[model samples]
Every structure is written in C-alpha cells, then in structure tokens.
Target: MNREQPDPPAGGDRIRQTAVRAGGDVIGKKVEHHHPAGPVTALHALPTPPAGFTGRDALLEELLAAVDPTTGADRAGVVVSAVAGMGGVGKTALALAVGAAARQRGWFCAELFVDLRGHTPGAQPVDANAALDTLLRALGVDVEKIPPALEERAAFYRSALAALSDRDEHRRPVLVVADNAAAVEQVRPLLPGPGGHRLLVTSRSTLHSLAGARRIDVDVLTPKAAVALLAAILGADDSRSGRTEELAEVARWCGYLPLALEISAALLVRAPHLDPARLARRLAQEGRRLERLDDGERTVRAVFDLSVQRLTPGQARVFALLGVNPGPDIATEAAAVLTGLEAEEAEEVLQDLAGARLLTSHPGGRWSMHDLLTDHARHHLTHHTGTEVEAARRRLLDHYTRLTADAAIHLQALPGEAVPATFTGTADALAWLDTEFPNLSAAAYAAQHAGHTDIAVALPLDLGVHLDRRRRFDELISLSTLARDTARTTGRTKAEAAAWNNLGAALAGVRRFQEAIEAHTTARTLYQQTGDRHREANAVNSLGAAFLEARRFEEAVQAYTTARTLHQESGDRRREAAAVNSLGLALAGVRRFEEAVQVHTTARALFREAGDRHGEAMALDSLGTGPGGVG
Candidate 1:
C-alpha cells in the first residue's frame, strides 16, 4: 500500500482524524497530521442502511423527479441534497431515513454509505480514490489484484463498477450514498459512470453547485411529528403510553431535532433513575443546556466540531467571516470582496466550506451557515481572526452596490448605447434578480434610509427597460414613484424630467393613458422650468404621440407645433422634419387640406436631403392620396 497525502493547495489539503462514532455521533481525539494520500489497493464494500426510518416523503419525491429513469442516464446522475436547518433539524436522521427507504424499495443492486465528514471538527473526509477503492472491493475486487497508482486505480475502479453498468446507454441499478460531503469535486471521482445505479447524498450544507442535483431543504419536524417520533423510540410499554405528551415537551425542548431526540432517548436508557418528566425539566434551562440534553458525544456541537477542526487557517477564516453577513447568504462575488480573494478562488473556498458542512450554497451561489453555525462562526471571528466583522460587512455591501448598479444599467437602455453584460453565470444572474427581488426592493428602501437620494432615484430609473420587457408593471409603478420622489427630495432637475418621463411610459404600457399624459406633461413642465430645451422638445414630442392616441387632435397639434419650433431653434433638421411630419398627419385629421399639403411637401424635401428613402417614400405616399393632392 502506497501512502502520500492528497495534494491540497499549500494550506487547503486533507489530514486523517480518528473519531469515535458513538450512536452515529463522531467522537474522539484529533489524529496527528498525516496527508490522506492515494487510494488503497485493498478494498472493502461497506454496510448498507437497515430498512425503516421515518420522514423524507417530500425529499424522496424530489430526488426521484431529479433522477427519474425516464430521464434515463441523467436519473443516474449525481443527486446532491442538503438537509440544512438549525442544529436540532433532522438532517442526519433524514439521510439515514432516505438510505433505509431506498434499500427498502429495492431500487439498487447494492448500497454503500460513506461519510465525507465535511462538517466534523477534526475528522478528515474520505478521499475519492480511497472511496473508489472501497467501491471496487465492495463490487468484489480482490485486494491483491487491485491497482495502486491514482490513474490505474480510477480506471480499474471505473471498469470494475462498469461491470454492474455496461458501456451501453442504460444498465443495472446501484445506489451510492455519500453521506456528509464537503465539496462538488470531492464527490465527483466516485460517481459511477452512466450506470443504472443512483447516488443519493445527504449533507448539512446546501449543494447548489452540483448541476442536475436535487436539493431538499430539511426543516424542523412538526410538533405532532416530533411527538410521534419520540413515541416510537421511547415507549414505556402499552400501559404507560400516557407519557406521549411528555415526549412532546422533550421534542420541543430539543428543538424538534431528530438527532437530539435520539440522544435524549439514549440518555434515558443510560440513566434508569431519570424520569422523562425530570429530563424535560433539565432541558428547559436557557443556559448551555446542550451539554445536559445531548444524546452523548453526538451533540450538535460535537458533530460540528469534527468538521470545524479539520479546516486549515484560511478556510477557517472564511467560515468565520461569512457568519456576520446580514442575509442568510452572500453571492460568491460579495464573498470574494469580503475575503479579499479573486472570484474563482472565492468560489473554490465556498465549495470547500460547503463540502465541509460549515456553510450552505443555495440556488444562485448564495452562501449561508445554519443559524446556530453562524452564531458559532461569529464567536470565532470575534476571538480568533483580527478582521473586524463590521468591516467585512461594509465591504460586502459596497461590492453589492457596485455590482447591482452596473447590472441595473446593463439591463436598461436601448442596446445601441448599453454595454453587453459579462455575467458570472447567465442562469445565476437571472436567478439572482428573481430570488433577490424582494431584497432589491428592500435595497431601494435602504438607499433612502442611508440618505443617498441620487442612488435611490437613479437605480430605479436604470431598471426601466428591463422592467418594461419583463412586464412587471406593479414593480414599475413602485420603482418609478421611488425615482420620482427621490429626485424631488434632492431637487435634481434632470432626474425629475427622466423619472417623470419613465413613469409616464410605464403608466402608458398598463393603458393608464390619462395618468401617462399627466406625467408626461409634468416632465415637459420640469424640462421647461430647468431651461433644458432639448428634453423639453422630446417631452412635447412624447406628449403629442399620447394625445394622438387619445383622439385629442387639437391638443396633439399644439404639442407637435411647439416641438417643431424647438427642433428648428436647435438646428436639428432631422427632428425638425419628424415634427413637420407629425403636424402633417394631425392637419389631415382636421381636413386642413392646403396646410397638410404644405407640411407634407416640406417633409418630403427634408427626407430627400437626409437620404432617408423610407421616410421620403412615406411622405410621397401620404401626399399623393391626401384630400387635396400636392401641387
């Protein structure tokens, strides 16, 4: 057997740990440092979970949907899920339940479970090569004959597993459960190639980084459900079943956590003298009651410690910084700003944190720790890292402001002048706007709170085109009003005109023409007030269009004529021609034959001079079929 540690980057690699698994809780001293190097030629297939555990009906359905056989090989694709919730949430129990359920359903030819030990304090994760070696052996490879080097071992591992799943597009079913993984890459090498087998993984952290993987958010068990679970575990015979209600109190006190409940039950077994009544009373204390309530070495803190202790200094620092973020998660870019790492490096670190079960990655690359974990991370940040918690938060918020402002501008405007967005992830970008829609509104509200009136006004105005395209009319109304009020607050003349114009357009899209005309008139008035002659002309032009649509011909003529005078004054002959065209169309509506002909004639000459063939043709067509033919 050859032993060399897995080559983790300078401070980011692996070391072995020896922890005692007491009642499925990892408990033990930290092993002296040794790299968890290359795989063992010797192999051992692991034991499968026994049948029957409660919970996870919803999880199983989602997983089955993700890996449906009708979807065929993709069904056999990696299904990474996180059983994330507070400390007492039944994440591990849910994993065990799913395992038991999968076996009970007879879905796989064989089953294997390996704990990646990502969240364990000092426990080193099982390496991919070592995992594959064990997989091949479990599939019945002889220890002496197995290959040694990484490449050969992987090939043999893939080949030996290939027997269970032929090279054909579809094959036999096997289910591999990688329990408690720390990263997307770590679980990658062990994936059985295009086999009929499916892998159902359970982790404390969300694994959204894994494409085509199903994510199931495990929450606290319901009060009724928790009571039922304790009843099933701690029944004092049929006669003493009145104590079912007592277990309910125990469940809540333990935070409806399945692991905690199991431990609470184990303690009752360990101490025969303690009554369920007394145990419930002891757990009710507000202090660090976790020590008293724990099932044994498998307390929530203990489970977390194994994963925490395994981290190198840098990875440890990242976990600490993330705990202070305001929201449940931060985008990878924001995390990069917080950690002073580049985006790619930040993503890799996030994956490590997630794989270690110290943090969770959500659908849009947002990272968060379980609430209790965040509290722990905050404590560590205060005492260990020299970086200020507030400083990291301030930097993250600044980065978010810059990114969101940039994105808003890119999303707005006609494509002619706007920059093409180079998004980190196209799927991620869209999902970020969608998932953070509420947060964006809150951000707008926050800008006002910070007394940044210009940003408050400009940010919403910047979103006009995208909102129009998306038809989020209600949001448009809200944002438009925010822009309008903000500009007013800052006495920003140009911004007032812009916001009023946008509000008018948005109102018009919803067919509130009267409100649009009123708003457009307000914009025109503001432009005129500010002596912004060019914007005044443009606003008048918009007003004319609206009047024409509303069948107010006389009003339309007045607006168009005013615009024509301004364009003429500005020497913008093309716009001058457009206004003359509008005047011609309005004149024809009122049967002013001679004036209409005169207007069309001017428009034709201007179009010809401008080399606008299409406009010239339109003018010629209108002039010919008019009430009075052009002389």
Candidate 2:
C-alpha cells in the first residue's frame, strides 16, 4: 500500500508559537502550540442503533457473513456492500444494525458513520471531497494536514486505514457506514485500502455503477413482521391486543412499507384513544390515505418528494405522465407515445427511474410504480402540469386504438384466408391482443371518462371479435355498454348501431337469446334508417342466427330471406351465401326436408363461387344430413 504519510510543518519545528494578543494570562505574549499529548485511540462515531429494529433476520445474517473479518481475510481488498431499496423500506436501519453487530463481534476495532443526505428533503448530497474530509478526521488526521483535492484526500484516507491495519498491536479493520447515498460517486472515494476494512452504503438507488460491491436489496416487511413492528412500537400492554385483523388491515393500507408503518405506529402511541379499526377505514380511502400517513412532521409524500427532486427534466415529465396511465403497467412504446419521447429515449429514462427505485421493471419490458408512489405522481401532475394530462391520456388511448384495430384484422380472418402481412401470423396477432387487452379496455373507459366519445366507441368496436374469440363475455359486455352509451350521447348513430351489434353477439355467446334478439333488431332498424345495405344485411343475418338458436324456425326463415335479398342488392355474394345456408337450416328446422336439400345445393354453389371452402364444406355436410342437421 502507498503509505504517503502526512508531512510535518515545513520549518522542522516540533512546536509552533502563535501570538496571543488578548488573553487573560498573556496580553502580548507568544503561546506555544503542540500536538495532542498522547496517541489518538480508535474513534467511534456511529449513530445509536435504531429502536425496535425488527425482522429481516435472514438478510441480517447474510450481510454479517459477507463482512465477517475471518471470511474477508482471504480476500486482499476491503469489502464493500450496498443496501439498496425504495424509500421508507429501512435501508439505513439495516446498515446501522449491521455496523453495530460487526463491532460487537470484534470484527473491527473502530466504527465510523456519515449521512450522505442523498435523499434528505431540502438538502444536496455530500460530495466525495467533503466525505473524505470527515473520514480522514475520524481516522486521527488533523484538519490542517488533510489534503485539498478529492484524489489526495481519498489516498490519505486509504493510507490511514492501511496504517491502522498494519499495526502489530491493533490489526483489526474499521467499520464505515455511508448512509443515504444518492449516487455511486458520493461514496466511491470513501472506500478503504486493500486491508480488509468494510464499507456499508445505504441508498434508495441500487448504485449499480459501483464495481465489486455486494448489493443487498431491501424490500417491504412481511405482513407478520409489519404487525410485529406495530406492536413493538405500541408497547406490550396496549389494549388493541385481540384486534389482529384490524392491525393487519392497517398494515395492508400502508403497503407494508416500514416508514409508513412507523409513522402510523407513532400516531397511535401519541393518541391513546384512537381506534386501530378506524385508522384502517381512513387509510382504505386512497384519496385520504396519504393525508392520514402524516404525523404532523414527516409524511410519506415528503419522503417521495425527495426521491424525484434530483430527476432530469425529461425524466420528470415522463414520471408525471405515468399518473395518467390507467393500466397497472406500461410497455415501452406506449410510454414513449404518452411522454412524446422516442422509444430509445423512453427506455433509458425508464431504466434510470428503475435504478432510482421509483419504478419497478418487469420481465416483459414493462414498468410499474408502487401504489403509493403512483398516488403521489398523480398529485404532482394535478398541481404542477395539469394542462398536459389530457393530451397525454389522449395520446395513450390513440396508440392503443391503432394497435387494437390492426390486431382485429387477424381475429376476423376466415380459416382459409390470409391476414395482413404486417403481423407475423394469426398466433402473433393473438399474442399482441392478449398482452394489450387490459390496456385497451382501460383506455376505452378512460376515453369515455375524459369525454373523448369517438375513441371510446372506436376502441371497443375494434376489439369485439377478439373478445368473442377469447370467451371474455363479461369484459365485452362492459366495454360494449360504455361504447353504446357514449355513442348515443354524442349523436353517433352509425357507431351506436355497431355497438348494438357487438352487444348482441356477446349476449348470444352467453345464451341470453331474447336480449340478443332485441339488440339485433334495434341494430337492423338503425342500419335501415342509415341506408347502409351491407350492414343491414349483417344485422338481419345476426337476427336470423338468434331466431334459429331460439328455435323459432318460421321467424328465422323470414329474417334470412330478407337478409339474402339485402345482401344480393348490396352485391355481397359471400354474405348472401351465408344467408342462404342459414335459410336451409331453418327450412329443416320446420321439417321441410326436400326444400332444405335444394336450398343447401344452391348455397354450396354460392359458397364455391365465393372461394369460401369452409362455408362450402358446411353446406355439403348439411346436404348429406338433410333433416338431421336442424338445430
């Protein structure tokens, strides 16, 4: 190790004399100054251990093993372990406990701790130069002899640790804890030399840039642990002993986060008459949850406020826009459109936020914020940039609308038909639809809520076929109702007719035949008024199918005959063939066997002409079993 020892005064004087102009003993005399009378013993500057530091038994054991001096002696360098987690998860508490435990185990002869203040409210992080000065002073270097620049000070700090490690009389290492570091740069220079000294850093960020550091991620407490912590804070003789369920509910409202739990516990301790069940009710209201989380001094909101204070302008904009997203998670491309950023730029910003623990990245390249953090982001957007929220939500809805429309083409394709080449195939299209279905459903509702009725109608209309294919009748019914009401309110007659048809199909899927018939009848009437012949034929065909399923053969035959005529007039030969096939089945339903055979033959010819092999095969099968094929 480079022992660049501190040099004495340049004059080679063992003692320096300074004039004392106004002292009680000497008014105009020179006073001699000397170094401390004896050698400086090992320093102890760590804060007191956190009160009621419960749980995390496995994590504590693992961290202790990582820094055990006996195990670290095999390695030539100092051990650097970082504790990273979201704010209010107790990273600092864990670090402090580890430092104290290490000292008690005789793993180190001295302990030093400093708060980097990385996420402290209204405070900037302590720079590396300033941190090194603190560490050097604790290591027995005089303030006057400490170096000026960061590099020199770091070397001096390491050398002092090395000197302590090399001493035959006291060869144990020193335990250093750097708490609340915002970035890796703040703690990099504080690393000790290759002498087995240990450095433990606690931060809201993961600090991935620090090389060779063992990262221990801290998360929220388990439900049992959270309740245990509450009891610990409320004392052993509190009257709320039998109310475990209410206590658990309150913990659930706090999201099992340590800081929120601590604050809630403090509130109960201060107000002895407050009921735990009542507290749970107040926190169950999400709008008032954060308000109740405050104890007149510290708040969950203030803790989150500090986490976002250091974000760049772009990151801040994107973070605020996340509040407007209704889905539980957002894909990268979707977030890009919502934030008006390029896909690549949005990905980088998302990863940065993940590093800062503000967002969590999932397996499919999606990101999500914690429920409490999302509430804070929503409040931030409402107060800081409310004007852009509508635009951002509109952009997100439009993006889903376009993608859903594209996926619908594949869902509507026939068995022997080709889909659009933009999609790989039917399977790929289905996967995209499956992944985005939740977002699309949420977007449709959000559009209606935001008064964008056109998008609200278009989105569910486009998703109708997929919802039917997946047997998601409940979701289909929900969105269809929204679309139907939104269209009627906005005077969109054509969109309303389409929504009615979709609702009819979903109702038919669930065997609600009478309601389905009523929905299709209204749709047919609307199409007739609009002079849309092709859609009128579609509505009539759907009406015939509902009649056939309801076992009303005569009404089915009448609806199919009219539908066939409408399709012929519109020059939709495929739909005409479909109507003819349904007419044959209705003929057999009423026991007209020979008439059914003739009608099936004609339908087979039309299906062959239309190049619909699947329809033609069905027609031939109907011809083979003339009376037996009736519904």
Candidate 3:
C-alpha cells in the first residue's frame, strides 16, 4: 500500500503529435519524435474513444443534444459544455465519447483538443498563455507569428474560428475539447467565437465560474453499468452468467469508478485464473483497496494523488481529518471540532473541497468523502501530514460525548422536569439524537477500538435511556455490550456494574428474562462489594422486574422485599413505592390475596407521600385486580 510512484505526467507528455486525421478521427500516429509546435494538416486530433466503451446513454444524449443543434439557427455564443467530477469518474471518457459521436454526425468539419494538465503530477498546469500558443499553432498559425500577450492570442484565436465560420460557403463548425482544465482562466481564453462552433471541457473541479456552460456532473457508474463494463473488458459471455453476482461484488469494491474498474479488469486479464470472488475478497480490505486497484502502469491512488497535490495546505489538513470520521458523513460542527477550526472556517474549507470534487456536499451542510478517497486521505494522514490522528479522534469522540450527555439529561427527565440549557426542550434533544445517532454509534466503537476506555464506557451509558425510551432494545443491547466489555478490560468495576444494569434492562426489554436476571444479579453483587447502597437497590429493583417478567412470582416477591428495604435505607421514597407496588403484584401472582391487598394499600400511601400520581393510580388498579378483591 505504500508504493509511492509519482502519477504519470498528463497532457504534455501524453500528447501524440504525429497522429493523423482520417474520416474525422485520429486514425494512427508514428512513434517517431515530433516538435512540440508541429504543423497540423488535419484539424481532427480527438483520441480514439476507448474500446468497448459502455453506458452513459442518457448523459451522452444530453451532451450531444446540447452540442449539436436540431435546427440551422445560430447559437447566442459558442456552445460550451463542461463535464466535471472526481478523478477516475470517467469525465475524460465521456467527453471523448461525445467528441467521437459529434464527429460521426458530421456536425463539425474540423476538431481540436488540448490537455491543460491542470492536476498532473510532477508538472505545473499548462499556463494560459502557453496553452494559447499551443491552440494557435494547432489552428495553422506559425509559432513565430502567434501573438505574445494572452489577450492578443485569445482575440486572434477567436477570430480564426470566426473567420472559418464567416465563410459564404464551406463554413466550418469546429469543436474544441479542452481536457483537464483546473481553472476558469485556462478555459476562458480558449472559447471559440460565435459561429456554429463549440467548446467541451473536462475537469475534476465543478468549474461553476464558466458562464452559461452546460455542466454535466459524472459520478461513478451504476452497479449494472459497472458490471457490464467489467464484463466487456473481461470479454465474458453468456457462459459466465453465474459470475454476475461475483462481478457485481467486485464492482462495489471498486466504488464502481471507471478507472478502478478498468484496472481491475486488467489484473484479471493478466492473471487469467484470478476469479472475481478472490479479487473481491482482496479488495474488501479497506487498507488495501486502493493498493489492489493498481496494474503497474496506472493506479487509483495515483489519480487521487494528483487531485490532492492541487489542494491548499489548510484544505489538505481538513481532507485528512475527514478520513478518520467513522460515520457515513460528518456535520459542519463535528468537522469544526475535528479540525480545530471555527465552524464558519471549516464550512468554507468544506465547500472548497466539494468544489474541487475531493468531498461530496449533502443537504444541511454535511460532507462525505468517497470510499476510496477516504482511504487515500487516511493514508495521507498517516504518512504525509503532520496532524496527529489520535488527537483528532479524541476531539471527535469528546465532542460526541458532550452532546450525548446533554441529550441524555433531556431523555431521562420526568414530566414537567426542567430542560437543560444546552437544548431548548425534550424535542430538540431527541431530534439531535435522532440525527446524530449513527455518528454517535460509530464514535463509540472508534473509542473502544482506540482504547479511549472512559469515553467508550460513558457514551453507551449516556445513550441507554434514549434507546430504551425509543424501544430500540437491539441497539441498546449492542451499546451495553460494548460498554460492559470495554469496562471489564480496564477493570473499571463501577462502570462495569452500571453497564450490566443497562444490559439487564435491554434484555428484559426483549423478554430475555433469564439472561436479564443473571446480568442484574451480577450488577447487584458488584454494587454491594463497592458499598453503593443506592445503585445496589437499583440493581435489585431491575432483578425483581426480570423475575416478574419470567413469572417466578415467589422469587420476585423475595427480591422486591429486600429491594424495598434497600430503597428505604437509601432514602429513595419513589423507588421504595415502586418496590412496594411490584411486591403486591408478586403476592397476587402467588395467590396470597389478603397480603396482596394490604401491601397494595401501603404502596398507595407511599406513592401519595412521594407525589407519584402515576404510581398511585397503578397501585389502586392492583388493589381492585388482586385475588378476592371487590371484583
């Protein structure tokens, strides 16, 4: 995974000058050396559309319809279309496909192409003035005769296209495809003048500054399309239909990006016996996904490196911070904490990263990195950057811990309880928890894995009340287990006892009463050993509830009787009243009718003293329903 070769130099080093045009396409080129400013007898210089190119049917139609008009009416200006996306998302392939289609339609008599080298490695982006020199020469103007200044060269370049279009007969409709432009400045000067001509640009950036340009955003291929493309590259036929599912899995591992897909196909092609299943298993390892996508000549990491190379230092740090975000996406506030930036500053940096296609922005100002890109950023964080990964993770976990504590306060509050100042009310706290639950869950796991034992134990404990209130017992069980195991590892006896109590409640929630009783018993014993009478009383009360659910009424009665005494000793009047009510229910379950009524009466008096109207109503109901009562 650490093989660090520089990305292949783009544009300048890859251009083929000896390539000749035939039938409106670059048919062939001599490998012999040619000058940089060589003469072009034919204007067609579009690279051959990739072999077996597949998909993008709808997008292809959209681009073609925009570039080639149905009527003979003149356009207001040159029809400029820009295809933008993250690296390896097939921007160049789609643009080249459009160029080939336009050529076949005979919409243009001549074509010109340039590689602006905007994000190339080990080389600077082609300068605007230098790009003009290249374009001017391709238009048949001698290098010595071309203007020196950028504006003069641009004016002359536009007029040359205008002159070709202004002809009375044999007027030319030229297509100038500017590939790999990093900025608007590199493209602004290259727009052909008004005629029926057009300019198509492909960039990793959104290039939103291009006025009136029809921007097409290319994302990863869909699973069906990715599989089809992979099959095409592998030349699989109907005989291999059984491998469709395996191939689809490989496509997912590749993130369905075209460049990665092509390299995966190449690996299979070279090995011949490496099946899709084995390849998928290798790719499933996140640490090695980008590594497995390489085929000697081209790598997904190399493509991504070029994009990262273009980012500012501040942006690069933020990008690395995002790598360790354990959830599907991160909010602006969380990102602010992770990067040690103000929310406003972090948001601006996030927007800039989105514009560069390094991150994807979602509604409500959240941002997410693509799977492969996240791996790359983590690699950068580990090897290339000065940022401490553990420190960043701690900040993130602490941020989530504080928010969860605030939410828990509101969740556990009784009716008419004062809401915390951190949240407006119960609804606000609940809403925050609902939105941040996935992130919170991930952060808890991250803390456990990173050995942040205290936060790991505290977070799940804080989430217990909320999960139980929502009846999400499955999630509650999971967090409780994490808290229990994590605490056991650190020998935090008090924390482990608390976690067992929570686990007991969650198990009872799902009717696993035997397991619930065992957990609560362990918690009670631990509490007794620690000399905590209040928590011990709480654990006994939970154990009583589990026994009652399991219909062990005699055992429930004994547990509640002891629990009632513990609560009284601890001066917990409301819990004492609760224990009395449960004791009455157990008495009735064991057919001790008169004792049940007498206990219910005492429970009613206790609830009245404690101002627990809900408990009093429950006790009155129990009195009526007891054996041999008024009913």
Q: What order do you get sorting by TM-score, best first?
A: 2, 3, 1
Residue pair clashes in candidate 2: none
Q: On lDDT, who's better, 2 or 3? A: 3
Write down the lDDT that model 1 would get. 0.58
Runs in model 2 lying further than 4 Å from the true structure: 1-293, 296-298, 414-422, 621-627
Comparison by lDDT, 1 against 3, better one: 3
| lDDT, candidate 2, 1-631, per-residue tens | 1100011112221222111111000001111112342323336877666577897788888888877877745332222333343576877778878888887888887788876767643234667876776676567665445555678779888888878677736698877888878888998888785777888888777777887677778878899998888888788899774478888987777677776776566556656787888766655554254565453213465445544555677877788888888766789999999998999999999987775557768767888775556766777786454567888888999888887766666554565454457577666777788777767877888788788888998988777766654535556677788888998888877777777877876676556889978988988888789987767777787787777777788998898899889879978676677678778878888988778888888988998998877667767766655333532
Worst 10 residues of 3 by lDDT: 1-10
Q: Model 3, range 378-402, lDDT digits (tens) per residue?
A: 8788754444778888999999999
What does each candidate score in C-alpha RMSD?
22.3, 30.9, 28.2
Per-residue alpha-carbon lDDT of candidate 1 for residues 574-621, written as tens digits (9 for 90 to 100): 556656766676676677878888898898787677655544665666
How does each model score on TM-score? 0.46, 0.56, 0.55
Q: Clash totals for all models, in order?
A: 20, 0, 0
